[model samples]
Target: MGVGDVSKRILLGRKLRSSQLGETLLPKRIALPVFASDALSSVAYAPDEVFIMLGLAGASTYIWSWKIGLAVAVVMLTVVASYRQNVHAYPSGGGDYEVATVNLGQTAGVTVASALLVDYVLTVAVSVSSGVQNAAAAVPWISHHEVVVAVVLVLALAATNLRGVRESGAFFAVPTYCFMAGVLGMALVGALRASDGHLPDVESANFQIIPAPGYDGGNLTGLALIFLLARAFSSGCAALTGVEAISNGVPAFRKPKSRNAATTLLLLGTIAVTMLMSIIVLAHHMQIKYVDDVSRLRDEQGNPMPSGYDQPTVMAQISKAVFDNFTPGFYFVLAATGIILILAANTAFNGFPVLGSILARDGFMPRALGSRGDRLAYSNGILVLAFFACILIVAFDAQTTRLIQLYIVGVFVSFNLSQLGMIRHWTRHLKAETDPAARRRMHRSRMINTFGLGMTLTVFIIILLTKFLAGAWISILAMCAFYALMRGIRRHYDKVNLELAADEEDRFMPTKVHAVVLVSKLHKPTLRALAYAKATRPNVLEAVYVSADDATTKALVQEWDDRNLGVPLKVLYSPYREIVRPIVEYAIQIRKASPRGVVAVYIPEYVVGRWWEQLLHNQTALRLKGKLLFTPGVMVTSVPYQLESSQIARDRARRDSERVKAGDLRRGTVRSGGRVPPGKQVHR
Candidate 1:
């Protein structure tokens, strides 16, 4: 075993056959953690955001924290219901992108994709950073090292996900479920205590929230209150960030993929809504005062908190209050909160790569992204997502509030467009069907989609109005970037496809086939090239060599005659010690003489296995081929003679390919001349 082979085996584990891919299909239990962790984890901090937003209008505004939570829950459930329809209608895992493309056209589709792409990247950044922030509450060291810790967590999460979905799910499922139980358990305990009038005060209960400018005291009513509610509702909508992931990852489910995914989505929505509402209610009951700016929170008589005061998150405060009698309960909730925040980002890991594969397969992204690695994971997409997420974490210093501002913009963009597309989807299907039952179902689905569109559109506008200036524009800019990039890639692929498309004129042949073999020595590689050229039986065959040294040229001419070679040998002299330019000029001259003729420049090349050996040969021939490839009436063929080392490389490739046996990987099974070959080839 080679060192590289050993390392790869250690990194990816022993390879599984393609047929075992079914083992990777997620069961409902596993799929929940894999896809819904993000939405569910919102319980940890979403309530804090609600209170913080309302804090801008003083503690009096805290009266409506539960109301904002309800509104956010409504939007979230509506989105989940709409996506359930999407999963059933299009279970191929293209999700919103596919629906938008098929119904609203490609431009709209790419726009959604771009938004989702940016959103997924932010999902990782925000989730990991938030998780670290939660941890910082329990461990003071983490607060000072937030960005570094978050970046490290992102990398570790990415590595875990690279092990394929099922494995990562099994690994993450425990923490995710524990988090759900801990938060829900805390909420239950708090409710019981509140009913008995025994609920304890939170850490921030004594602090009075001072309203920001223009919203002090009774300044929040009418238009001001309406707008404040909208802003708070928008902030609370962060709970909806990962709702669409289930729709995007429907294919990851076990048998009856759509049904299983929909069930998981429902559970996710219910748990998330219950948790968000419960947390908000608990915070209000405990009188937890949370604020965007810690300094905005003061003590009795409007006095500022002493320099040493601390303000924990709303969830943190509620955890302390509800679990005050039992220290372990508080620690358990905090630990789970931190864990779920980190794992919530796994939803993106499961989603973005699959969506990226679909886009790549459709020619919007580099085809390399469409490939699966040894573990059957979209490794390229995973890595790309992690890299960008790390960049954002570093840029924002892993501050959740800052990253949160940029968080839901993309999700809402996708949400609005996706719902609009679903409505169109149902309308188009209704046109093709006539059964009373089916028509009724279609109309019902369309109604759901329409409601979803209206709700999402309203929230989308609110998000823009509320958070546009507060880091949301950064996400919008990112979406624009991805849109332009994908469009450009698609345009390139379309142009190439059109240019290479075969027409009847493609069958037209040149007046004659001219073959020129460029040789540097009387070696086996040269002889093999000569044989391959002769086998083709061109109308004209000749050998050409660019000679910079007169002595070597004389020796080669003498050797050619001694060998009695039938083909003509032409030696072009290069006074400047250049080889490629002279041969390119010769091929061009040949083409001009017989514009109707085709020139096949057969370059005798050496194929070496080791990287360094490749550098030792083919420098001149590579440059010559590059130049002649653009010449009219030319076909540059690399007639390669494989060296012994190539056997090792070929065997390595064969073993690597054995791990994947279906889809595009199976293309290797196609015999030569049947499928288009690799590398550049030009013909008139």
Candidate 2:
């Protein structure tokens, strides 16, 4: 046990039994929030974006919000149906990357991976930032500290996710459900109130929005209006950011993974569309006009009242009007909106890791990412997602509006690549199918993919054209950077594989083994090393020391003679008090003298527990081993002697592992190297 071991245990958490892996699987009730929150929570801000983009032309264009919402809903439904085919066809959890690489080509798969990675990062920044803004609406103290608040929330989410997916999923279920119920309930109540002539008007209804520099006072015709509308549609498509997570996480579901994932996707689309439409309708009835300026929203008069006014979110404004007389309803809507914003990023957390694991398995990422943790989950992938998401949060100061500019590009890239891949998959499969039924099934899949491809490609072009200068270029640059990075990693791995490959030229046998023991003074560690080297029965064995002082060197030589040591001691004189360099030079001299022989250097090392103890020892041995490694005929071996402090570290690790815990969900009754009992394979 040592400081390194302690740090590793702290980072990775205590090991869990293989049998307890089932405890990490999610039931649909919890999985919905875990995987669908990003899409479902878009209702809070999707309408805001729509209004914001339209506000560029003034509020007169707000009449078209429903049309845009409907278009987005149709695209979402098409994409979901298209992905149902994806999950069912390729349920190994590679998702878009797998679909593209297998069906399209390597280049397309890389394109999809880069897009998904960028999108996942934006998801965290946007969702957490939106959550912070919602919180600011309630607690003004948070307004000035939005970035700090978002960063803190990101860290908390990372810690929760590090506990395992099932745990975090269950924890987020309440907020997600509450958000759905609150929004749906408010919509219903507002509808009834409107029918009874008791509906309340939103605060924004009193204010006016000035059109942008070039517009027809928010009433326009021709290409200019169409372009503005397209930009709004692209922005509204932010609702689709997390839709692909279901396909990416198919393997995480229980039995019938593809079917479950497809069902979940349908549920996500229905809920998101319903919530989005309800909020838009309610906002229209409430006359909510969102403004980019918090101070400019006034009640027609020139007075800047209500402490300069902090404009609530689109959902907040709708909630304020719909629940004008019901304080609890307002609070419920506000609270749920805030909670869902935070949990929305959880979908990215779940998706990014799974996609990273797939990439790693495909040799595009570090192999450790493909390996499972104690929970049988891809923990490294989760950690990588947390790290990148935190970087984005800090970079953008957690402002959702600014972050939103970088959102849809990635999802669309993935969408277009995946759809194109699906089309290819059907074409390839249809070539082999002779039966009419099989051919018909493939044809149907192809048609679904063809429709999806057309829609996604159109949106992709819209996103690039409209958002290129409005910060979308940043995402494209990021995707390219990731693509180049992944390509470089693959190239490095290929080079290493070539270098390490075994061949006839490298199979030559060594003539003899010559063992050298590094000695400072005759101590227990040195004695142990000498004994161990002797047991190897090399062709020659000797003890070597470098002498910087004559008195100590003579005493050591006399002591060696007095003890009648079995091995001979060779001493070298050094003007400077250098130890590692002289030993390394001497080892090279021995190896150069006998080119065909192998020189084995046994260095005695002390194993200590405390971090500070490491600095006090092994300075020379470490340098010596590093230098000796380059010599062609030399091998370095460490002989470890554990000190008392090591026992404390070992005990600490054992306690942290919690081996005695009996009833924990992540604990199990299995012994070492044993299989789990029958009927205990799956966890709820």
Candidate 3:
């Protein structure tokens, strides 16, 4: 194989046949990390956002941290329950898009798709950025270079995911589980210490929070206090961002896909809620002070924190205080938290491509996205998600706080729509059901959906009211743009489908075929083209040459006449030294003369296997074919004469194919006796 092929094989591993797709299906153990990492990892940063928002009203307002966490937990559980119905009903893996499309209309479906697509991109950005930010707490050097690190992390995650679902899931499952263990272990230790009255204070516990300009003295009441609490709740609701991915990825689960997926969702909700609340309660009990602005922190003497003071993240502070006696436990928690946050982007990497494939299959996206790559993954969609995510990371300089504002708007938009769609789905099903048992089940499902809709709708409105000016508008605009672009793509596909529909006119045969073979001189390639054209037995045949030099043209004509080649030689002089234009003009003339007939042009090309040799030959023929393809009633054919170098390439390919891969013999794809099986031969 060539260098490029070798490199690709090393990077993506051996290609699997289409039948091996079933082998790639994820079991519940692997599926949990693959689909739930985003929600689970949110505990690493979601509490920090809550504390940051509440710090606007000073440390006294921090008392509301656990309350906000509870509110977010309720929304998350409701969303999880609602999507359980979704996975059972729409197991084709369309998720919210399918639900909205089937129950509502096409517009609603497209809107949900646009929102989900935007949110997936944000998931990667926010997750990676937050990871980098948390890492900065332990490694101060990373703070200055957050953008580069975050971008590299995004690319690394994309490459890992390109190796297919099962492989990537196996790779990420350990770290995800480790993160869960570390955080929960730390929380457990902190609880034990607190019960014994031996828990140490966090580093920031001694610093006083300076309230913002409007909320001075932490004595707010009325609309101002309500708005402050609303803002804090909205920020905490980011925990609900990735709950829909499981519903979207139900097909990736093994046997009883919907049941496994529902179980995974329940586990995701329970674990995520537990971790989130644990972190918030610990931070509050330990008086962990996290703020957006460092100047807001005051020392015991009421002096502002030093300019260069680097405050650790909420997780970092809590871990340090909880594991103060054991240094290794603290670093382990931080390391696990950072790694899990980075791996959280894996959830989006999996969900985005599957959803993109579905969208492409439905004609709302480019067809190329629907195709599987050599590894049987949606490589195009993965690359697209990574690219946009890198752009966002760079554009915002990888600041989690800045990107967080643009994060949950799209998810909430999808959540509200998805919940509404489920309500309609159950209602429509109930209308058609006659059995009392099934009817009662449908009623219960509808009620759950109705409650879900109300919860999500309230959260959506709160997000809009609290975050619109805080960069949420940008995400809304992005969703609108995606919606319009998909609609336009569907329109173009439909128009092309109509234009290409076969009709009686397509059945009509051309009256005659006027054949013209392109020639520069008398040679084996030119003669081969002449013989091939004559073999077609067209109504008329001629050899056409573009002449830029008179003497060369005369010699060629003299040689042609001396040989008495049966076909007439036609020479077209080009004063501008343009070969393609003359041939295009001549073909157009022939086409215009007999509009109902076809003009066939034959060009001889030298096929060279060496990459550099290819550039040295076929320049003129390549340009000529490109021009002729655009002309109506014109057909261009390439008669290739393989060069000697091509034989070397063929030999190399043969040797490469003969080489045994790792699992060929074990899988019975190749025989140990060195004899080929009937249908197991490699064709490429």
Candidate 4:
């Protein structure tokens, strides 16, 4: 293997065979972390959002925190159940994008695609940002360099994921499960201690939150109270950001993929709901004080909390309070929570690639995204997601609250559209089903999806109203941009496809063939180009040279005559010392003169071994080929004359091609045409 290839193998680990893709299929245990980390890790800060929003109404409104959690949980459960139907119905891994497209038409599909794609990018950004923020609680240095640390963490996650799904899942599983155990364990311990009357207060419990210009008094009533609660509920809905990932990733599950995926989805929802509600309940029980700004905390003496006050995250406060009796438990909770937050980006890494592949297959995305990498991972998609996530992290300074404003919009948009699509899906299925049970099941699913649609739509509207000006407008604009771009790509593909449709008119050959060789000097490459052009037996064959210097042009003409080369020479002069445009104009003139003829422009090119040798050669020929390609009735071909240095390259190419995988073995090998003479090179 070449150095680059070896380096790649070292970085990505061993290259898996296409057949081993089945080995990469995740079982429920591993798949849980691989797909559900984003939703699960929201326990780290999602409740803080609820607390922050309620803190705006002062501690009096904090009573609504658990209520907001329950509402978010309800929405999450409904969305999960709705997606269960999606997995069983459209288990090919198109997820919401596929469901919308197949049920509602191309525009709706692309709309959902745009939303989900945006959501995936935000998933990485928000998760990594939140993770880094959570880490800052333990690593105080991270607070000063949060953005840089967050970006580095994102790159690390990208590298881990590029190693392949199964491998990355292994790396993330322990941290994810540890996080689950830590948080749920904290809740259990906290609850048990409370029952035993030994539960301690949170570190921030004594620090009072200053209300943000509203609701300083008790018993606030009417529209003001309703909007504050709605805003809190909408903010809390951040918990639902990654719920749809399981539907998007159904294909990565083990055998009986849909059923396994559904079970995983249920598990994800139950765990997320359990953790989210548990954390909120613990925060309330322990009187955990959280705010967007630490400076908002005032002591009982009516003074701001001391300048040295180390305001930790909600998770930290709760961990400290619940695990105060055991130092190791506190440390474990903090470490696991931080690691899980960092690993939560794995959800986007997994979903974005799969969704990108599905989009590529449908011609709504770049074809390159559809290709699996050396490890059977969609590497391009992962890189793209990481790149955008880093941009958001850097742009927003890696503050979770800033990034969170742009968070739930995309997922909610996808949720609303997906449920709407599922509603149509079942309605369509019910029309075709004759079996009583199947029809009944379809109706039941339709009812569930319809209910989900209503809930998500209400939440989506509330999100737009509450968060549009906060930062969601960026996500909204990004979604529209993506939708338009996909449509533009599809249009281009459709136009090219229609234009390339086989027809009898296209079958007819040119009435006359004219071949022109682009020559710079009377070298072996030029001679080869001339000879190759003559071999085609065109109706008209000539040597075309661009005269940047009179001396060189005369010398070339003299050599052509002395060698008795049969083809006549045509020279085009360039007073400006240009080579490409004059030849391009000549070819265009030839084409215009004989519109019924095909002008074959053969250019002599170099085949060099070393990378820098390419810079030293092929400049004129490359320019001429680029110019000639756009001219109608003209075809540009390169006749490469391999230099001595190219032997290494040629041998390397041959040997590298020989390293095909086991599946590449032909069942019935057949030999074709005999090898050509080494003197000639084919223009493929």
List the pairs of residues colliding in candidate 2.
none
Deviation from native of the Cα of residue 348 in model 3, angstroms: 0.3
RMSD of 4: 4.6
| Superposed Cα deviation of residue 354, candidate 3 (Å) | 0.3
Clash counts for the predictions, in order: 0, 0, 0, 0
Candidate with maximal lDDT:
3
Instruction: Write the residue-wise lDDT of candidate 1 on 1-684 in tens digits.
Output: 568877877776766667778889999999999999999998777777888788888888888988788888898899989999999999999999998999999999999999999999999998999899889889987767999999999999998888889899999999999998998999899999989999998877888877887787576778888988888898899999899999999888998999999999999999999998899888888888888787887776778877745567777778888988899999999999999999999999999999999999999999989988888999999999999999999999998889889989999888888999989889888899989999999999999999999999999999999899988999999999999999999999999999999999888888988899988998999899999999999999999998999999999999999998798899999999998888888888999999889999888888889989989988887778778878888999999899999998999886665443334334354333443245533232
Per-residue lDDT tens digits for candidate 4, residues 377-469, read 999999999998999888998888998888889888888888889898888878889999999899999999999999999999999988999
Model 3 — TM-score against the truth?
0.97
Candidate order, TM-score descending = 3, 4, 2, 1
For residue 449, model 2's alpha carbon misses the true position, in angstroms, by 0.8
Can you write out model 3's per-residue Cα lDDT over 1-684, one digit (the tens) per residue? 778988999999999889989999999999999999999999888998999999999888888889999999999999899989899999989999998888889999999999999999999999999999888888989979999999999999999999999999999999999999999999899999999999888999989888878789558888988999999999999998889999999889998999999999999999999999999999999988889999888998889988888888999999999999999999999999999999999999999999999999999999999989888999999999999999999999998999999989988887888888888888888889999999999889888889999999998899999999999999999999999999999999999999999998999999989999999889999999999999999999999999999999999999999999999999999999889999999999999999999999999999787889989999989888888889999999999888889998888888877777777766666775573655765433
- Screening candidate 1 with a backbone cut-off below 3 angstroms (N, C-alpha, C), the clashing residue pairs are none
Q: Candidate 1: which stretches are off by over 4 Å?
A: 213-218, 299-310, 428-437, 522-524, 558-563, 607-610, 639-684
- Model 3, residue 469: C-alpha shift (Å): 1.1
What pairs collide in candidate 4?
none
TM-score (all chains, Cα) for each model = 0.89, 0.91, 0.97, 0.94
